[model samples]
Target: MGSYGTSMAARCCVTDTRPTSNPWVVLATLLAIYIVNYADRYLITGLIGPIKAQFAIGDAMVGMLMGPAFVLLYVILGVPFARLADRTSRVQVIAAGCVLWSGATIATGMASGPISLTLARVAVGVGEAAFVAPAYSLLSDYFRPERRGLAFAILGLAAYVGQIAGQAGGPAIAAQHDWRMAFYSMGAIGLLLGFAALLLIREPRRSGSGEGTVEALPLGQLARCLVRSPAYLFMMFAFGFGVLSGVAFGYWGPELFTRAYGMDPVAVKSAFAMNFGLSGLVGMLLFGALSDRLARRSMIWPCRLSALALGAATCAILMASWAGSFGTARLAAIPAGLLGGGWSVGFMATLQYMLPPRIRAASTALFLAVTTLLGFFVGPWATGALSEMMGHDAAALRLALTLIIPFGFLSALLGWAAAGRVERDRAALHDALSIRPAAPLLARPAAEKG
Candidate 1:
């Protein structure tokens, strides 16, 4: 089975051999975009109660805003833009995306009602669709496989900070200055960083050397490329369920506190920031590092032990939701967040493991497609829709959020099965290390390259 080799190095987005002057600028630019990315993506949660009250919408509509509306275009746009990133300067694509989405966030602030908010959200999804596949690919080229986890974890740090700021701070900021100011500020930061990313991060030459040869997959051709691997299919479902459950927790967390514990807005904000935000921050870093270490030891970490552990943890977390005391669930939140963060470890590992170097971006895009279609689109909306059908009561919310437990367990089972096949299945994957061909006397099939 394949595992990234050992190396210890770090740098901003600046390329090593390239004439490009400052990679840190790229790092800063991407980090800034991530901050804006998360802020725009999540600001709705912060504003949800007020927005719902203003528009007379229910939790279902609120769920849709965070899910299907944003996720649909996000899934669609991801691959095509990733194709462009493989062919062109990733920096340019990211800059353009930043501009599109940042502007969209501002328009969201201008939204007077639900339909406009939904439409503006679609635009935000479209814009963001162009960013991630390319950004992940770009960052991979600059950082060695060993260090990429840390870089990505740092990138996730920006997201966690944004989550805390967007969710925890937004309500408070909106209370003082209006949600419009928060949206405008987030958008403005993106616009400024868009230019900066263009300046600082030079695109590295496409990777196809030590680890592997580049087998370029063209745009519109990614679907066929996905059919070869059983592991990929399992990973898809695994990643989908993991992300879906995470979004459920993010969307309903504050409301859960309100309905169950009768906490006021201020207390909710504190929990959102300290419990979810702070805990999530620690979770991301810890899980990222842990996955890398495990992946190094176990070639099949992507579909291996991580999933087994995650499934068990998820079951316990679901029960925590029904805890008699808010303080108990509050204490439980720290470990729950830590385990929840493990999803990214598996998710990113799947991307890195399932494809060879050349097709990484396209594979990532396709992966995002599943993640979007299932995780973002269905998860939150399902919770809210179920909640409405059960009536506007606490019991309904409890039922809806709790459904994720079974799905998470199901995902873990699939991953464990995939891991069982690692010895029989992953022998072909061992050469995923160095790119050069073995002797013609022992040639393996090309289709098994990843």
Candidate 2:
């Protein structure tokens, strides 16, 4: 194995500066795009009631529209989109994706019923799929392994910003003008931002000679390498379950308040925006910084912290499930959002540290497939199904939400199990990639390797 210490030192240096590139500029531009990403993605969640009333649908149907309907295409296309990002200009890909999703979000506003709206959501998902994996790859190039937790934390905060805007603004817009206007306004904002991303964000020069040339890895080889790492497998599975819980809350929490507590959609969404969204922002920053610090002591620290956060988040969500009033739900959101935010920053940092730059985007796509498929595809639908089965009332929804909390504990256990194996798996991957001094170390083109 290449010396772990040497590789880490090299990564730290690479992260510090690209000499010609301004990473902050890249980050700022991407942040704007991500905010639009979530705003378009979750805008519907805030207006579920109006959509349902118009279509005369139940919770299960709404859940399907929000979850699997969108996620199917999102997860399915992620790998190819990531491959495109890996082989092409990531900036152009992201810019194009932003435009596609923005247009699709606008189409969502034009939908008259479930069929048209669902199709528009599918298009939105496809556009979003193109953005995230590549964006992570770009950020990995901009920041070093040690600083990645903080970097991803900062980027992850865009979700809250988007959620705050979407949840708060969507309901407000819907209240004043109608739900269609809510979609139209957010879509317009995203379309403008898409053009700005194309104009403003210059893709950084690729980092590290470890990967030699900018050649794509064969998907088979990439899969083989990942399958060999137990840590990666466990961590990915942990996130699958972990995100299931998060999606359950994020997609349905607003519904919970509106239905269970007799709160106004605007009031419920705004309160969630502040309580849960802001709490998550705090957690993302705190745990990201904390994970970075602890990682200097041991690679396992990131996993350890992730497991800890999952445990805390499970408790917080369970508390919310049982709360008797809107005020109590707000109180419960604090730790749930805080701890939930840490999971992404921690796991992303850990996973990136273990991967070669050549396949980082692909690896991220793979991870997202699992997480989004389970969390986005299954969680929301399952919650809605349970709520329907139990009686389609406030009490039933609360019970359904409570039932999802146990999976959070399962996620924590799996994350903790992966902690002991991270360093070893990281070394294994480094060795497999066959590092050399300065020159790119990964496989050259097929002809060159032959």
Candidate 3:
């Protein structure tokens, strides 16, 4: 197993000696695209009330729209798209994805019924699935291993930015125009960004000393290698639990604020935008920088920091769920957003350390598959069903939110456990594969060898 791991590393990992241009430009462009990416996807959540009234539907149907309508195809197509990213130009894959999803979002505006809207959302899923894995893979190449936490965290900040744009802007547009116009507007923004990505972004050289000497490893072997690692399994499960709680709240929290606190749609949208934007941004920057610093001491610190942050996030979320007033809920959301920001930076940064370069994109796709399928699909759907079962009232929604809190704790615990094993896994990869930490972009020689 060790020998195979070493050989795989030697075959797959590229050591790019060619000096690159400012990688931060690449990071900024990708970050902008993700902001648009998330804004288009999450815009629907803020408009749930208007959509429900328009279609004469209930919370369960809205949950389906948020969850399964997109996630099913999103998870299914992730691997194949990720494979394409691995084999071809990642920038092109991302540009194509942006166009496809933007087009789908525009079509959603024309959705006259639930069926048309659902199909449009499914198309959005297919487009988005193409973006994430490849994007992560691209970022990994632009930044060094040590700096990835911050780079990825900067990318992760898009979630909050996108949500802010969607939640704040979507409802405001809907208030004046209608839900359909909001969709059309956001979709148009994405289309513009997609074209910019195609024109401005340049693909970086893949790293590894022996890149042309060996063929890429088969996907079967990569899957087998990952499955056999205790560290990978633990990290994925931890990510799964965290994503489940996070998605459920993100998708449903707006409705809860409206129903339970009697806030207007505009008020809910603004509050959510501010809450996610300010708090999540603080958390991402703080924890991402912290993780990078602590990682200098030990690989385990990132996971440990994540474990602690997850616990903080869980407590904050619980406080928000039970808070009687809108102001109190917003206050609670601060910690939730801030701490929640750390999980991606910490765990994913840790995962980057463990994985060989060749398989990074696929590993990310697999991570997304598990998290999206269970977290995005089952989490919101189950919450909606639970609320309906409990009577479809604000109180029932509160209860449903309460039930998912345990998953947060479970996730924190998994991170704690995973922290202990991360070093061992890193050691195994190093001892067997002779892999060392990657040099930061521009640190190597400027000349490329033919």
Candidate 4:
């Protein structure tokens, strides 16, 4: 098994040593595109109330729109798009996706009923499926491994920024005009950004074997390479479970404020946006720099730090969910926001570090597919179903979110498990890629094994 995996990794083509373009400019353009990507994706969550009222639907239906509608095609097409990126221009793939999803977002605003809305969302998913994995692959080539933690962290800001734009700005626009107008406005912005990314972002030479070489590993071999790494397996599940709680909260949090406290939707979204967004921004920068520094000593520190942060964040999420008053809930969200920001930087940095360049995009797509299917599909849908079963009240919603606490703990445990095996996996990857001498697999001293 180990030898086969090594052969598979060794099959990867060489990376280009020549610089392709300005790394900072590429980063800036990709970051801007990502902001639009996330904003378009989550805009519907902010308008859920209006959408539900217009369609005369329940929480379950809303969950269907939020989770299954978007995630189904996103996961289904992600790997194929990633494979295309592995062989073609990742920049072009991303540009096309941007245009496609932006068009879908506009279509969403024109949907006449639930069916039309769902179809539009499915289209959005198809478009979005092209972005993340390819983006990560591009970033890996543009920035060196040491700087990736910061670069990815800077990129990670899109999540919070997009969330704020979608969750807060969408509602604000809806309050001023209507829900459909929010979609139209966001979609238009995305179209312009899509063109910008196409024109401004240059694809960097991949960083493995030799210049101008692209290797297309068979799907079976790619699967074998990923599965053979225990760290990758554990890390994948850790990411999936960690994101479960976050997806649920992100989708339902504003509703919780409105239902539990009778707060206005616009005000709730804006407050949640500010509280979570600013804290998350600070946390991402702090943890990104910290992880990079600690990584100099051992890669394990980043994973350990991620686990610790996630565990603490879970506790804070529970506190926010069960808080009696709105003020208390907002206060509790501060810690959750801060700690929740750590996982992405660690996960992205470690995943890229452990894989060869040829497989990076495809592997990332697979990882996203699994995590999105598990977290994005299950999180919102389960919460909605559970809430309905418990009588669909504020208390029921709180309990439904409470059920997510165990998954958070499980994620942390899995992260720790991944941390224990990361060094070994990284060593094996290094040997496979022939970046350094191939040390005897079992000859390492016990002290250095992990």
Candidate 5:
């Protein structure tokens, strides 16, 4: 093995002082918290029909509520919170965020109009911003790089499970009572989980190069470092574009099903949730494990895998959107879910490997802020605006979704490009951190082997 490979292997094999709680237990707690976090965020998507009816809003307005209202505060606060996590206890940062977002979710149930709902959503964003970066950083300390792929995969399951809860469970609750009840129930559950996270999870010691403790870079230095890395830049945009279509579909897919097939909202969402959830579960685990094993041979494998999977996924989603019937749509969803679900696992694992420990959380936060703006903010809002311009019909919605297909293809290309740059960039990071670099593990392309 080369120096980079040897260092990574050593990190993986070294035993350290164990945390008070088991690492698996810690992972479970983080997973639960993450599930609740996403469930609260996506509940609005599931309740769009009821909320729109109650507020008498247009599709453009609904888009604003779904995209800007939540994402504005989320992307804005993410870096600051991640910096705090880098300096303080990540567990506390995450727990506090869970509590804040849960409370805001409850407030969403009480909104009387669009303005109030937007405000409540903004608060939810504020809390959610604290979770992802810190949680990923903390997990790195608990599980070594070799194991992180599986650990993150288990955590990644929260996204699909949460989607099921919010996209499916929300409508079910609203059906039983009203849309407001959905928020109430999800919020209450989140609040309890927040408290549980604080009580149950213990903070692990941060890992670093054995030569010395590495401190996080200041905001300016961090920005410069990210800008300097061609691989990071490519991957960041690739991730952004990769997720754009999926986010649009998640926000609008249920409504499309209802309008296109005249299916009941509850039934449509339930079916969507089940198809997506099961397929995603399998895909996440499979790709995560595959990435880890393949990466032993080459770091570029993760990016290569992501690019291929995303390209295939784009085709699947296009088919699902234009399917003739709900059954056919469900069939299409199986491939879409399987292919689309694991993109983040490889992206994130590769990113974590490239960055130093001190800045991992903050760097992740910065990366997310950009991607969230590109994916979360732009996807839903642009789709809604296009739908409204096109008369807000089923065909218009389908066309809008179709337009997003090109972005997925673009993402795949960029991911492939990123693969060529990752090993070089990772080596540069090691040099910049003053860590010793080992011999080459595998020969790289002449241009990228630096």
Candidate 6:
């Protein structure tokens, strides 16, 4: 884990007059690489129809592909990689993850059936597991705390941007060629992008004490420390419940849309992905920016309010999106995306604000393991199981998505509480530890990090 608060003096040095390095430039580069990261990772969803047709399996198999199979590998490897990120160059880890996932996605293009594709997805998830935590730590190194919400918002935008390309662009590409080509082409693009990321960004100087060695807490000590941090617990809980609601529904999106709207299966596959892809982008861009501005101005828990708003609004929209007429359903999509994207950026900020730079990556890996199992591995799979148990009803799936609303309400509570104490905790910890600014904190753009 790297230190998040690199000291106001060091932060000012970087933020002031460029001082030779630009955090914003670093931020932009990370965002671009993230776009490719996402495109390679999510392009598989656009190929669901062809994959299913080739395998002749049902939603159960799809659930495995999107959920447990991917998550299991992601969680299993994420912690160790987090440690690696702390030890090695985070930029290197990110670049390696990009290459690994891209290679895996390319392999998926050649998969003959369910097991092969599932294994390939496993590799993709494992690679992705390495990217995010270290990247966040690097980002904290890149910018000052005051600018963190915006920095995080920009990084969060990658989720939407990458997804848009994967969903909208992927379908068009798939339609023109084939699903296999879609995977192959995106993977190839990502491989090239990884090289660019590696070349464009050099590792920034370390922020505190200019120490290049990664944060190294013993496993027991790390676990004990995390247990004491309310912020960390709340962060994990927020994401845990959030994912249980949102990711679960997202996993089953095509089936729900097809059953409810009576669309062609192939079309639903693409449409479902694109639907989420587009609306999610808008919600993230709008709500994320708005939330950051409000947080900066008022600091009264903008993320919490945003979460509450999205939960309440999307509950109605989720129902409408499924039950209403086609046009109405399309109209409801905006709110649906509000729930998906709004909390993501805000929640991420909360998580970052909760931990110190020294332990953030490890903390990230810890929560990721828990949340990955609780949400990605089981949420979608259980929803599908419940949907199946309920006679595989579309209405049942709708009911499953409604779970997000209440879970989001809980996340709002957590976010609200976190907002109040996050800065206080950050300050208290820094003062108590007599934290110092690092030499590298003033040197480079984007920390040349993961």
Best by lDDT: 5
Give the 10-residue window scoring lowest on summed lDDT in candidate 2. 437-446
Please give the lDDT score at residue 55 for candidate 3.
84
- Tens-place lDDT per residue, model 6, 406-430, is 5655755665666655554555434
Model 3 spans > 4 angstroms off: 1-21, 212-214, 427-450
TM-score, structure 3 vs. true:
0.90
Q: Is candidate 1 or candidate 2 better by lDDT?
A: 2
Q: How do the residues 18-107 of candidate 1 rate in per-residue lDDT, one tens digit apiece?
A: 455344455566877887898787788877777888789998898899888888889888888887776677789899999999999889
TM-scores for candidates 1 onward, in order:
0.87, 0.91, 0.90, 0.92, 0.92, 0.85
Which ten residues in a row are the worst by lDDT in model 4?
7-16
Could you tell which candidate, 2 or 3, scores higher by TM-score? 2
**Poorly placed runs, candidate 5 (over 4 Å):** 1-15, 18-20, 209-215, 435-450
Candidate 4: pairs in clash: 14-209, 14-210, 15-208, 15-209, 15-210
lDDT tens digits, residues 1-450, model 5? 335545433454223545445677778999999999889978988988889899999889888888888899999999999999988889999999999999999999999988899999999999999999999998888777777788888999998999999999999999999999999988998889888988888876677744234455679767866777788889999999987878888788778888999988889998998898789889999988998898888878888899999899988988988999999999999989899889888888889988887778999999999999988899999889899999798999988888875699999999999998897887666555454223222223333646
- What lDDT does model 3 reach? 0.81
The best candidate in terms of TM-score: 5
Per-prediction tally of clashes: 4, 3, 6, 5, 2, 8
Show where candidate 4 strays beyond 4 Å.
Answer: 1-19, 430-450
Ranked candidates, highest TM-score first: 5, 4, 2, 3, 1, 6
- Model 3: per-residue lDDT, tens digit, 214-315? 234467655655665677788898888898988888878878888998878789767877886789998999998999899889889998999888888888
TM-score of 6: 0.85
In terms of lDDT, which candidate is stronger, 2 or 6?
2
